[model samples]
Target: MTTKVRETQICLVVFIGLPGSGKTTLCRLLLEFLRTSCKSLSDILHHTISICYDELIPADKFRYQDESSQWKQARRGIVNYVKSLVFTLKDIEVLNMVNSLEVAVREELLKVVQNEKKTRVYIIVDDNMYYRSMRYEYYQLAKLYSFSFCQIFVQCSVSDALNRNSSREQSTAVPEEIITRMAERLEPPDRQNNPWEIFSLTVPSEKWTVAEIKKISLFLNNAAEHPVVMPERNNEMCQESRRICSTNVIHRVDIMLRKLVGDRMRERSQTSVQRDDLQELSKAFTDLRHHILEGIRTGTIIIPEDTYEAINLDQSNCGHRLQDFLNGLLTIS
Candidate 1:
């Protein structure tokens, strides 16, 4: 008599924190623990894959301000790659361009797809996802694919992060300013506000221990066993999901507008623009941003069905609108 093979389970484990918060260290430890613990289960196979954005994207690409679009493209590529892996490995070109480590992981994933054994696949995404929008992307992906989704926030004090960063090698160490900025902007998972982030875990890095690995493993196992379920159309859950998406889009747009305003102020200051005039320009941009956000929140501004596309579209439109307003002001001045 042949034993029945259990269905394959897939989970997307996202790590969010500031750089030097021990996210990478915790990921390594968790993967090691999972692999070792799975050794005794003959009928079960556990496959853990680590996808580090730092490894996938070149470090220098992040230095230029204008490269934000490219950064988004790289992020989109990672999401697409994960989608392809979860559904079907049809993007061979993407597979070809990835590094050797990712290539090996893909090969293993392919085996799991072909094999008859009961397998549990865990894809750990290692990155400093300081924005809630960033984590929401993976949550959406998990919901779309009916895969388990969980976030691990490796919390560390700014002082601790700085000390740890200082101890690192020159090439590997992140700049102090960058770490400080990230810590300030870091939006750790809030399960109360964001219902979708309920599966998240916040681990204080300083208090982390070998015992924590067992706890993490158990959490991951539970997540895998219960994947995200897609909400029915026109239901309260669906409406709430839309609200969350809109909130994320608004937050992202707010960040973009602030950056644009700051950049413009800096440029005008260096071009002999009067101090009063610069203040006026800043005020105009701030007011316009507030108006735009209010319109979005009040349902006066209709967001597109595709939230991601809406973000880029709205951002471009806002930039042009802001520039037009600036041009009018310059002409009047």
Candidate 2:
């Protein structure tokens, strides 16, 4: 006799671990299982949107040296921006799923609902979610969307991860130094801090047997039993998180702008400066400040006009470039 597992309704499964910890492998395995074992067509498709951070990196970035502070800042900022965007996209994707499901149910064409039960939306966000703040971002999104969120921590010893990295192809293998640093910094998920972690899975260092993988597949299929409690739309914590992110981004930009002005002043031979340059700089800063405030209010990020041109004027400028940065951050490339 075969046992049937209840399906999830609007769920997100995030893979968190250091690079080379088999996160991608685990994600692929689970994805295949979900697609094959689905009870219906809608369940098979599941409105699944798989987002992997590694694939989002632009080809030009591969040539960038990691030694510069400006580069490092840009990299981190871009990562944070992408993280925020992922959360935003999740809301949109869920809404789309709802619309699609509604149409499917109305048309009465497919038995997406077997035995009068509906299929669910599923998302897989694959990345090295190393920090608690990263997980918290998703937690907030899950609460807002009324989706069951699960964190799958693909755990492996530092040595095992390093060994795996070493064996990977040149195009895919992560740098050993980066792997070591991330291993040192990873924050494993805990159920104590957030109830969402209750549905979390921890894959061990050893390879998962087929039976074990099947068990995981069943576990996820039956996740609807652990329904998530959606928080109020005007939750104070969400507002606070938005405030903090906006403030940090504003502060960083302000510091860089100030340094740019200082560098220009030092380059001037005479005591008097070009009023035009000063006015342009001032206008740029003001526009950036206003746009940032707006972005915070609207839950998006912005790049002030000509900000990139100004930064690029000084070949050695330490200021973060805005155009390519924004494109990369928003995954326009």
Candidate 3:
């Protein structure tokens, strides 16, 4: 009698946690475990690929390394807008990059599965899946490919995360304040409410081992037998997601705007601008403060739609105003 081989298909495992929460550490350990465990599984030969969210960020004019110049130049204004709002815009860019990479990675994994015919292909996504929308993106991908998707949330206290961050090299360690805010805002996976949360594991205090890896492998093998049904987004959830996105965007814009104002104020102080003129500029900012606050509360950044031309025009006007103010103060010098 001949024995038939059981095969595991393409699957995704996403890590969710704050920076310095040991997410990357857990991923490295899990990958090592999976590679070693595959040796014992008689018919299972697993090929795994790891993708990091930080590596997806673009470095060139397109803000992404893999983009075409023509397409990038055409959408340069959008790129500038994204760059200007450095905080929340990174999240948006990373999400879109992840979505695009998922398709390509899935195709490659499927090809391997097709060729091997009896082997498992796993894609490990290492990132801070801090929001539900981020996790939902991967969940949708799983349903589209009919592949098992799992999440591992690395849980650590804020103090522990801070201490871990401090011990890291300067280049890798993010600011302590950013980590603190991320811990406060992190939205953990809820398996009961969302089907994409299959094989969810919470590694508390960063304790993980080969046993956890085997458990996840077993979970995915079991999950393959059952089809995933994504839950509908209720009105409440929709509202909450929107609220979170809007709040983050507004906060980032506010930070950028305040920094711009501070820079201009320092420039004015260094110039020969008179006290009266400085007071007038300060009053203008005071007036604009109300408008800025109003815009934030209304969940929008109001800018003229003339694209790059508008940006240049605004800069020219500001430069002219500052020059005139300084020239008017030349008598005092």
Clashes of each: 0, 0, 2
Model 3 C-alpha RMSD to native: 15.9
Tens digits of per-residue lDDT, candidate 3, 161-199, equal 999989999767777877877777687876653434646
Q: Which candidate's TM-score is highest? A: 1
| Candidate 1 residue lDDT tens string, 1-333 | 112334667889999987788889889888888877764345767878888887777776363222244776677778787777666422222244366877778676665666677788888999898867667778777887788999999989999999998999987888898888788777788776456788999888864577888889888888888899875557887565554545666777576656766776786688777889778877877787676667656655434334334355664444433332232222111
Q: Write the per-residue lDDT of candidate 2 for residues 153-206, one digit (tens) a residue.
A: 888888988998899898778778878877777778766533446788887856
Q: Which portions of model 1 miss their true places by more than 4 Å? A: 1-6, 39-43, 61-67, 89-98, 234-333
Stretches off by above 4 angstroms in model 3 are: 1-8, 39-42, 58-116, 224-333
List all candidate RMSDs to the true structure: 9.7, 12.6, 15.9
Model 1 residue 229 distance off true place after TM-score fit, in angstroms? 1.0
Give the whole-model CA lDDT for all candidates, comma-separated.
0.70, 0.56, 0.56
Cα TM-score per model: 0.68, 0.54, 0.50
Strongest candidate by lDDT = 1
204: Cα error in model 2, Å: 0.5
Model 3: pairs clashing at backbone N, Cα or C within 3 Å: 58-63, 58-64
Worst 10 residues of 1 by lDDT: 324-333
Which ranges in model 2 have alpha carbons more than 4 Å from their true place? 1-8, 40-47, 59-117, 232-333
